[model samples]
Target chain A: MSITAPQGFVAAGVTAGLKPSGRADVALVRNLGPSMSAAAVFTSNRVFAAPVKWSRQAVADGQLQAVILNSGGANACTGPEGFADSAATASRVADRLGLITDNVAVCSTGLIGVRLPMDLLLAGVDDAAASLAPDGGPDAARAIMTTDTVPKEAVAEGAGWSIGGMAKGAGMLAPGLATMLVVLTTDAELPADALQGALREATRLSFDRADSDGCMSTNDTVILMSSGASGVTPGVAEFTASLTALCQDLARHLIADAEGAAHEIAIEVTGAASERDAELVGREIARSNLFKCAIFGGDPNWGRVLSAIGVTDAAFDADDLDVSFNGVMVCRAGQIGEPRDLVDLSGRHVRVTVDLHAGDRSATILTNDLTYDYVKENAEYST
Target chain B: MSITAPQGFVAAGVTAGLKPSGRADVALVRNLGPSMSAAAVFTSNRVFAAPVKWSRQAVADGQLQAVILNSGGANACTGPEGFADSAATASRVADRLGLITDNVAVCSTGLIGVRLPMDLLLAGVDDAAASLAPDGGPDAARAIMTTDTVPKEAVAEGAGWSIGGMAKGAGMLAPGLATMLVVLTTDAELPADALQGALREATRLSFDRADSDGCMSTNDTVILMSSGASGVTPGVAEFTASLTALCQDLARHLIADAEGAAHEIAIEVTGAASERDAELVGREIARSNLFKCAIFGGDPNWGRVLSAIGVTDAAFDADDLDVSFNGVMVCRAGQIGEPRDLVDLSGRHVRVTVDLHAGDRSATILTNDLTYDYVKENAEYST
Candidate 1:
């Protein structure tokens, strides 16, 4: 049971030679329910992809019957032709599924600015539609990967219902959906507005804090579709919690598979004036190449951590800050406290706690340490 | 003849036990001028080091008699005790030179948060002052390096006057002076206000455009001094051009010798709505790890270029942009223009040009590709 764990969803992934490796590069997810309720979040970058532009408009009505996702070529910066290609892809999906084009959402991820091989992409769409099955969720998850080392999926079981999700993408991932195509299916009887609220709230705490490289993608999208197949109406708050938990799981998965990352860093910024201030501080540390490299090298260079904090507007006294690496307090009252040797980072997971000592608000952000493999993979990614 | 090439200046470097390698770690530059005029710019980071806080105040009156610099200790996030270390270092230097401490500036680099060995530092100040020589510029330059592979020095000759400078720092360098220390000496008879204005103007085009790694340093500083020994007061524009040229030369040197850099990238952003917009675009591109890695791999991935542009506030029509790698126009009208293989990137230097098709404004930024050695050096730096 995967995305098909939900009662009314069918998904498929197919290969149409779009990828040189002949890997599955096309995926489709359809919600055949009494009601089609959905919510989606896209990249905030102004120079977005053609698929993003089209999906933004298509997702406006808060209803979606199906979503078509493709890898191998991101239809971004392809000008009007890219937009036309995405439109044609959606129209073809709608025609195959006997649904209107407006009810079909599209997502594409790969090298940007190159036109999709229209002939192959259109053919792949038909194959994806014909192969749709409840157990095709894993294939769909694998289809939209660009540089991801593995497929990512999450499931949360509720009373007589469940939420299933599939995601693809690893680096170049940040807030505002960052990078990737995430499709979640839930059979619970929740309203569209409720799904939107739950998604935003969940993602704000989950995916929004997953800042791997501080690079935001042009084609990032996260969509959730409700089929109401369970016939079990749950409180929006309960659903939101379950949904957030599932999203958080997938978010962590992305960090684990991040490019060239030797360590997964979880920075917890406590005692900020506000949540935004906490986020800003944590993100500054997450994005610091100095700190990231220190983590990669297994050095508890807390000075780089403190310096990264000093560059932000977060409310923290230079003389009163506290920093802990792993579980040892390396800095106390803004001065070196314990010997850095007391702390250990010889593991894949490293946690740094920075207490701003300003207020009670706090935020936790996840990032990956800079590594040699990340450089190798990205340097020759499109070659 | 670097710092001391200009008349009325003497420089010295001395060994201090601060660095484990026992390399020279203390440098002093003195002004023996008929007109003692000086100006300095410091990192705008909120968490600046003790020396930055001290020098910002000392140089405020624009009458610096000397600057004492040290490596192996950043003296950042060490709180009030750190500030005292900077103050005591200045006082010791001033006492030996028979001058007030307020007339002396200070700069420090290396591992942050560690208090400088005050005993070693103070003793080294005396040694540096006693050994002051007119030809000690190269030694002074070498004393302040951390991970730099070579010393960065530049000279520009003018009519009856010359400007000479030395710089240290690589990586974690960006605007607001990046993470570097620069000392520029001139024999021109310029007033403090003129020196300040000229320094700002020159740095706006030179040091400010060197955006390597996009990490701001708490100890970053660039100082300019006029000794009036040559007795020639060139026009402000001429002095600005000469100083800017010298700084630009050192800036290029910094990029060329940047740690773990396989390619030197000169990103030129043209057709922007404003110069600020152009700079924003260029800097965004310079900071993108994905884009930098592509350059390191010798991949002419212009799509990564567009993604970087999309994340900035720079005014540009996504549909009308053009990009060139090396000399090949890989993207035109925001679509694939030429085959990426048509371009070559085997050389040490590479250029990426972005045509926004928005307006006439343009700006250029210098950067280096993300390399494994960068990861290796930076990862193991603090360890």
Candidate 2:
């Protein structure tokens, strides 16, 4: 289920003095390529990290040979010096690998507005590039994590094609393009345009629907690189389906590790006029503090859900809306439907369904409940 | 100040067995008018309470004599039967006072999605109508409170003109058009159009900037009634000034009594491209859970503030932004500015200022921080 499962790809992760705990802090992935066609998606936040700026430009020509990531300092808002540090790190990796600097992408996640320890980061990049191996994907996954409770890695394999990805984020995780730092590798020989098109389409349903908190990050980057060394080119239809499944698996892992999360809740909005409408309604309900707290306390307070949905522009009659929580019909046609018991909420998963009764288009958003530990963890986070 | 400080109005509050606690649950206010003209603003929430629907229809003709309010239950989503209940309440009050049913306005605040206790509610309405008095404003204010630690009332006097108001809301509070049930009474000889114009202008700067928990209610209503019992008419300039001061006072009281709120934080956004931009930035910062929790923990985490503002479309560079928390310059031009100990945030007031470095337009939003008690209180909230 790791990136090594992808054909003609090798990955490695190691510690090079970036974090004091000696956990993996540097990860490298290489595409043993006959063709280097690739694509990437990054955060839309205007205040982006230096690594994001470099990777965004690197993917402009739609080709990539490798990706290097670290998880100790974001190197964001550190001025011109931070940008130079990111470029220098990429250059050092390219020099050691005898590859073009523009063909390498970089990502960093951790504290913001702090200068990266260049001496340590550059040395880490060299060590990571040297340690790259076909079975190093798990180590690479462990290296690109900050506050994530577990490493997130997913893989989808078929007869002639393979898809694999690793993601790391627990907070500041809302979507414009993607939520956090992610690297996806594949071996199917696909055009650059096709890869980019498939990445965007896959993210719209997967990473885009995982909202832990409403904060969007400044360093969210998702890179998809194709080695094209396996001599297998699946049809676009199968490639897209595999990509969707892979992204969904990765998104589920992200939510399961959301910071201080209690129950992982799935909010489904059905019978909306359009997919966009359904997403809007689902996300709105997912982000409501009242609804989240109710889930935390195990109360079937359907009024809060209806009120949250009613505020959105999604077309639906309040009287025609129906809501269910954990298989209990709490509200029907906007009125209290059936009386349900408020019992233990200790389970790790919960489900909420909303029937908009407008159209067939629907969307599902994943979120976590608000709990006391969530408030405590974030309240003193900066200290 | 209570509503009775205003000239030419009678108010009363009574208990008629609606609430199990036997507290004041019904209130009545009447204008002994030589002229009767009014204007009102209703909640933008599509699923509104029955009283909101009735008042919206009643105020269409721009004339009103009385307002009947109950605080034990919000008759929302009770279907056609709910509308019938609202009309019957108005009819009972109108019959007692020999006034037209259309001249009476109704407002209710409490739990949503439950039908009004018809027998108790009707009895309370009749009792409140009979107990109406010229000096019962304080009683009326006390009656329309649910989970509020204190009652909110404000009064302002002009040269022969006067204005007063009462508000009730402890949660489900946020910006647009105010997030609670409010009734403003004025004795100035003014038409409905002038009252509407002034009310909108005042609310934009006052009630519209208050955010308790970022949840907009399903029963928000702000009504302004002109008894015109006093023959003197203030000029537009003077009337607006008085209205602004009155609203400001009421807004302060509302924030002071916000449920489970320990501190009142004022977020000011200055040097924006436009007033709208300033308000947008201020509200964004105010509603950020991270920022609110930081204040609660007494940590001056200015990075959260910068990141929150950075996500908006406001025309300001991160490096050009300056932020101060509780008089400490924590960030300058998006970078860490000054080194100071985090101020004590255990007090009842907190302030955050953001300098956008764009223009002179500015705005301020008042809000309360997220605390443990807030979650506990809201988690147990049910009908």
Candidate 3:
């Protein structure tokens, strides 16, 4: 019970013969309610998949009756024909559901610069929309995976309404956004604008803070749909907080399942002049290959952390910085303080704290280490 | 003969008990000159080593009598005491050579936030100064290494004089200026300003373009010394070209010796609006961990190349980009073209060509594939 965990929503996952494994490769979620509204965020990359182009326009109407997703080919860099394929896909989904094309959103994930298996894909849309069920969210989540080993799903209950979501991604997951595909559903009474506001605030602190591989994807998209079935009109702050907490949970799920990652690092940056400084410092350290490699080796190399932050424009004095790995203060006041060997890293969860010693704002960035298996998985991804 | 391949430089490498391996960890280079003109560059990282701070000031007068470099400790983030250690080391070298402390530059590399073994270091300075010889460049080259497997040395000759140089750096080689220490000796009758201009242009094309691991070090320092012993007033063009070629040779050496690297990747971004665009695009691809990992697996994942450039502000239409892995042209006009398997990465050399088709300028960036040994070395480095 993923997306179906919420009321007034039905979903289905079906085999499209698009993937070489012939696994379930198509997913659909439909709104069945008195009110239909949605908001979405797509990849910031200028080069995106065909469905991203189509869905971006479809969501502009502030309401969506259905969302159709396929995982096999990215349909990115495929010229004008790719966009035509996506539009045809939305039209086909609309034909089966008896709705206009603008009320349908579309997304795709997989290899870039290749055309989708359109024949099998269009047929799967009809098969999927026909089989929509309230309990099909987990299957829908599984259908959208490329390299992910498991499906990701979460839920957050509000006063009388609830939010449920499912996501699929494992690589190219730096989230400017990642090649991530996500759909969240709620039965709360909210307009598209309100949903959009909540979604932006939630993602900014959740998915946006994850810097898994420092590589932004071309097919990232996250959607939020509301049906107003429960008729609970929660305040903006109340709704946004719950959504943010839910997204943070999903973000942790993403990192825990990240490809080739042996350790999940929580880099919390504290004492910054502004929130941006803290986030920038955290991202700078998270993206350092040397630091990641050191973590993979289970060595507490605080110098790599300091060197990583030294390149950023964050407000911090070099002499006033402090670093702690695990629970040991290996570096304090900018100098070696404790024996690095005293800090153990045998556990999968590692926390590194970088104290800017400047102000009060802080931020956390989630990432994984640079490992041999990560190299192997990605090297053989397309092969 | 490395730096001493020129006419008026003496050098030596001696063990100082700074390294546990008992290897030579101290290096000294002296300019026995008719004219004592010199120019140098330091790391752009604000959080730099004490030696970088001392050397930046020592070379401000455009003259340096000698340069003392040590391995095994960076002496960074060690507070006022670290600066004192650098100053003391410089003063001791000045006493041995009978030069002002202000004219003696010092450099240190290795673990950051730790102080150098000052007692052992000062004694090694005396030993190095006593053994300085006209043909001691190779020993000096070997002494400055931290994790490097081999010494990097290069020489290029002008009409009547020659320029010779040595460098040491492997990890953290993305220079905010080349994150390495270098010493160049030339016997031409050139002014300090002339040498500075030549060094900048040469390094901008050479070491500055090699972004190994995309990590910037705090101890990067490059010093150029001119004895003017040959009295050769070569034209600026002749000297600049020779210097650029020699620096390029050293840059290749650095990439080849990069830690945990198996294949060397030359990312050439062509048809850009400006040289800066070309460089930015090249670096965007070269710094990609996914792309580097893909290269290590001998898989031609040209999609990773396209995605890397998509995140940059370089001038390029997504539809017109073309990518080739070693000449197979896997992507043409932004769509799938030749089969990815047609590209062979069986050798140690791999070249990726991305044609923006946006303009006339182009640039090449040198990097290495991410490998297991790289992760192993960095993980165990501090231990």
Candidate 4:
């Protein structure tokens, strides 16, 4: 169970013959609720996909009846015609579900700058609506995968309600949200304003900190919808914390299943003047190809980490910085500390900690090591 | 002949027993001139190497009689002890040449966070001092090689005078200067201010635009010394232009020999609101791993290019962007134009031109395609 694990949500996955592999390529999640409230975040990249433009408008009213997603073409940089295609897709979904067009959101992912096969996609939507089921979340999660090896789903329990989410991403994961498509559903009673605030706060600490390849996508979107079936209105603060944890769980899944990744890295920056500084330092280190390569080689290269940190505008004294790989401090007070060989990097999970010695604020960024497989998968992606 | 091609310059190379491979690891370039006027630039990275710190102070008085460079250890993040080692190396060089310690600059390259073997380096300086000759530039160039495949040397002649230079760098090349050590000798009469001005201007247009791997090093340095032996003073503007061309020539060599590089890509962004904007756009595209991987696969994936451009803060209308690969207009006005198959990318060189259609400014960034070998080289570098 994923999104449909929550009450008042039904979903379906259908084969559209859009993907060359002929896998399930379309999914639909409908909100059947006493109250419908929704919130969403999209890729900050200026060159967004057609479906992103359509869905932005659809979610502007903070209420959505359904969401239709396809994983065949990104429909990005396809100009006005692509926008029209997205609008037509929303119209088809709305017609099949007997919902208003403005309340139907659309998402598309795959190769950028290509148009979707409109006929097959519309037919798939019709079939998905006809096959909608409360237990279809897992199948729906599998349909949105492009290069992902497995479907990602997570659930967080509340007193009388719950939040369930599914995400699809494999590459081009960067800050401002990874190259991903995510849908979250909750059975808790909440207003649109509360849902919107919670979603923003949750994503800021979750999706915005995952910088896999430093390539922000043109088709990233995350949606959260609530239905009043559970009739338990949780406190805004409590709801936001739960949502953040769930998003982080899904983000971890995205990285663990990242395209060609061999190691999942957590760069934690502590003793910063502010949370922003900590994040800036972590992101800079996360994006350093040299550091990533060093990790992949099973080398505790704290020098690369310091060099990466030196490039950022974050508040830190060069001479006071300390770095650790795993539990071994490789650099202390900016000098060689323990023997680098003492730190082991053979494991798939690696944690690099940086102490700025500036303040108490901290942040962590999730990333992957740069490996030959990563190069292979990305080099051969569009070819 | 490289730096020794200019009058009043003597250089030598010697094995220092520092490199594990038993290669020559020490290089000495000395100015035996009627006038000693020098200007130099160091890496902007705050976490600079000990040699960089030492050289900055040595050249602060607008004069330098000698520069000693060593490979196999960068002497970075070594704290006070490393600085002491650099100072001792300079003092040894100065004493061997019967000059003041302040007149000698030191440079180091290779793995960071390691101390140089002082005894071997000092003895090698003695050997280099005894072996210094007017034709020793090429030997000195070879000694500075860490990962560089060849000795880089160039000469540019002026009326009754000339400028000669040598450089060594193959990886960790990025904007604000590549991970390189450059020594330039000029026989023409000039003041330190003029040399500094010309050096700054030349490097701005040349080395600063070459971003091979986007990993800035902590040990980058460029030194320009004027001998004034020719008694000919060229106008500053003419000398600056010649110096720029010379630096550009060396920069090209660095890119052509970038570590594990398959193709040398020139990403030129034109019609921008300003030169800074043009460069910003070019660098953004040059650094996009997705775009670099696509290039390695010989795919004219203009979508990656557009997506890269969309993430920049440069002034450009997303819908008005145009991209061409090898003269084929694959994307026009931000949409598909000619068939992508029409673009050929079978050669070692690739030119990706983006027309922002916003203004008259332009810039070109040189980079290398991400390749399996790149991953292999960087992954195994420290190990």
Winner by DockQ: 4
Q: Estimate each model's TM-score.
A: 0.97, 0.96, 0.98, 0.99
Candidate 2, CAPRI quality class derived from DockQ: medium
Tens digit of per-residue lDDT, candidate 3, span A1-383: 97999899999999999999989999999988777899999889877778888999999978998899999988887879999999999999999999889889999988887788788999999899888999989889999988888899999999899999999888888956655989999999899999999999998898989988899888899999998889889998999999999988888889989999999999999999999999999999999988998899898888888888899999999888889999788888888888987999889999999899999999999999988888888777761
Report the error of model 2 at residue B3, Å: 1.2
Model 2 chain A scores worst on lDDT over the 10 consecutive residues at: A337-346
Give a tens-digit lDDT track for model 4, residues B226-266.
99999999999999999999999999999999999999999
Q: Let me know the DockQ for model 3.
A: 0.78
Best candidate, TM-score: 4
Put down candidate 3 lDDT per residue, B1-383, tens digits, no spaces.
77999898999999999999889999999999988899988888878889999999999889988999999888887889999999999999999999889999999998887788899999999999999998999999999998889999988888789999999988888956657889999999899999889988988999899998899988899899999999998988889999999988999999999988999989998999999999999998998888888898888887788888888998999889999999999998888889877989989999999999999999999999888888888777771
Error of 3 at B16 (Å): 2.0
Please report the candidate that would top lDDT against the real structure: 4
Q: What does the interface RMSD come to for each candidate? A: 1.2, 1.5, 1.2, 0.7
Off by over 4 Å in 4: none
DockQ, all models: 0.77, 0.62, 0.78, 0.85
- Model 2, B134-237: lDDT tens digits are 88999999999888878899888999979989998888788774567888998899999999889888888888998887777778888888888778889978
**What residue pairs are clashing in model 3?**
A175-A178, B260-B374
Q: Where in model 3 is the C-alpha error above 4 Å?
A: none
Give me the displacement of residue A331 in model 3, in angstroms.
Answer: 1.4
Q: Flag regions of model 2 displaced more than 4 Å.
A: A20-22, A342-346, B340-346
Per-residue lDDT of candidate 4, residues A102-201 (tens digit) = 9999999999878789999999999999999999999899999889999999999999999999999999999899999999999999999999999999
What's the distance in Å from true for residue A48, model 3? Answer: 1.1
